[model samples]
Target: MMQKKAVDSVMEKIIAQDLEHKELESNFWTMSNHKWALLAWASAELDQSAALVHLDWHWDGINDFREPESRGELSALASLDELREMIADRDRPVDYASFIAPAILFGLIDEVHFYCLQDDTTPGLSSDLLDETRAKEYRHHNIDDLLRTTAKLSKPILFDLDIDLFNRATPFYLDGPEYHERIRSFLGKCSDLIQRAAVVTIAKSPSNYWIKNEGHYDWDEELAGELFNEIVPIVR
Candidate 1:
């Protein structure tokens, strides 16, 4: 059985107070890498179990996060640099593609509803750390499915987005205008969910070369900015 650490720290209390005061200034974050979202998720003052709505171009469910020696391991992560060192453990491999598994296993999130532009080749996550008894996983191929599932979630939500969701296998896949429109449209549809989320993490993923196409190194960064602009008004 997974041992869940108590989340009654002073920071958590402060977060609760902030929510009570309608002070949501710091609940949203943008990171250069996807794994750093772990920091945002851990820092939030959410219920023992929260629902995760992840939008990305890839599944990111590889499930190789080093098992925490104690339940407090995630709560102990103080900074993105510390998280970088933790995920850098070569043998255990807690990377961008695997960070979600630890969050679920550690009880920060109890269920995941995943959406990706990529086809649903990965049916589901099957790992030793994750079983039927642990977190539940749901996959969606389009915005309609994601919205339908999210509308039914009763738990506090952690909304995660990877800018690569707008990427394709080849360079200049959708053209500038169409790509911008798609990003805006998707965010517009999810604005209500984004506003209700207890925590929101956005990944820039500029170095995702496999799906980014060889020469288009900074395209995702551009898209990340576009995503940021789109989200600002909704959360404001």
Candidate 2:
């Protein structure tokens, strides 16, 4: 685990928006912050035409607001303001579930390689709302296929990892040693291609209505810390 000061310093580089230290310590902080931090970090660090490798249990590719029609052609060089406008809805500015859709629509990501538990043909992988080009840029893979394929990615990569990818069960019920090994091995394979990375460790909360885990409301700060430690050195 990083010392508080070290973690704060790293976060300072990644978070382009204002966020209080107290909020970082809170388990109930907005999930959008986590997603945006990764986007901000990648925007600042990577070259053009970077690829986003999203590893999660759920496909976060939903175009919830359908901003593409009005936004027109979104350039990869889009400003943060433009990106913000593309994601905004009347009730909320950016939703965790739908943030990736805006990222794709805004051309922040040239290509998306999604690794999930489900097959490529699953309903969650459907890109019915996206235009043809955007839909073609998306490729799906099974989570466990990382080890089987020797495919190499030429473009710089932004790794978007959600902790829930490890298991559907509550964090309390997770197999700690096995999860650590899996994370370590998977990251080891992809580290060479990664330019930056973002990790989301969400604790089930009422505000996040999508998460159905009915366990305790406590955040898995320890697991987050462990994953952060494992990731930071490789990306840095």
Candidate 3:
């Protein structure tokens, strides 16, 4: 049995606060948000030129905030100061929707293999921003394909998992016990390649921003705890 007590103390506190609110707004813009914090943590642990195995519902690789021309110039940013200036110009240094773009621009990630759920909606990447070399570096595959092909990779992986990938509407969705089992099985299969991992559990709250207002799911303490229990061991 996955122990709820095993959840991180800080996460436990956050969930406790979330339970008190009727609808916790998505705080992806904030530096204190778990998404940014986890990415920051992963960035610190991962070496330059590491492969990021991004498993999520959304593409999240787009340069949405900046214009195509401006983003195309990111390759020219040689120093950390230049990169900081670029991000600061957008007024959002680290946004969840476009963090991967900056990470790639800054050479934090050399390759990104996106494993998204099977859906009709095709997310497009800016052609101007990604030239031939960079375009070849980014590849998209369905989740099932990822499961089948991930075992073949010998390279060190930075596993980036978004819980929303297993949205309630998807076949991967399950109650706590089954969800735990599936995650364990999946991670066990890819454990050898995973050098470090980051997990993001989004509740999909009502947002005035670009995000769609899907009726929020209550992924409070119980679900968060279960997920934490399963993920912590593999990543650690």
Candidate 4:
């Protein structure tokens, strides 16, 4: 876990449009920020044309730092190190709020389909990268609908989950009991998807929706642990 100051400094690097922080390894990752999942995806030898199934509280479809003239460069960045270098070289940052579009442009994923637990149905922010890439976004509030739709798709599935989805009412509302129930319900109902996913990436999104404790962000770590324990066996 990064100190509050370290987290803040990294957040500052991410442009306001793609608000977040950074890295983790492995096929199943639980990082402080969702943006780092970008690198995790690149680390794997996933299908070049995989379809992303994003289950989160927010539609993280913003492309904060898109270099249109650098399209060839972006597509050429096939390795995790190359992607990290490209991100470091950019003046603006690639963050949770806006990494999806670039993932598509980079040939990492073909399209992104969303299932937002919160009522945040706003479309992804428009940008030059999204315009030319195969990425398209939408909201699927119903689990059955989301499952049925994905079942028909021929593309490989990359399941991306954000912990914030379990506690959707953040800043505005907080219900401890309801939060636990939401987590249980999702895990119970989505076992099939968990088992089916070609790759699973989870975001611990502490700064975005978690509560602050005596000296640290709360729930993110605990929930991440719980998720790993539950998901590892299923995926394995």
Highest lDDT model number: 1
Tens digit of lDDT per residue, candidate 3, span 1-236?
54667557655664443232111222111122223422442334444355667766667655653656655666565654555444434353444456676666555566667776646554535565466337334455545566556556554545665555545445556665676577677667656545333322232221122121123444443444445445645544
| Deviation from native of the Cα of residue 106 in model 1, angstroms | 1.1
Per-residue lDDT of 42 in model 3: 36
Q: Which lDDT tens digits does candidate 1 get at residues 24-107?
A: 358777655577676678777565788989988778877664455543565577775666567544343566677787777667
TM match of model 1 to true structure: 0.70
- Error at 158, model 3, angstroms: 2.3
lDDT of 4 at 210: 51
Candidate 2 Cα RMSD after full superposition onto the native fold (Å): 9.5
Cα-based lDDT at residue 123, candidate 3: 58
**Candidate 3 local accuracy as lDDT?**
0.49
Task: Estimate every model's Cα lDDT from 0 to 1.
Answer: 0.66, 0.47, 0.49, 0.63
Candidate 2 Cα outliers beyond 4 Å, as residue runs: 1-32, 45-47, 67-78, 81-90, 118-126, 135-151, 168-176, 195-236
Q: Is candidate 3 or candidate 4 better by lDDT?
A: 4
Model 3 ranges with Cα > 4 A deviation: 1-48, 68-90, 118-121, 137-144, 147-156, 195-221
Clash pairs detected, candidate 4: 62-98
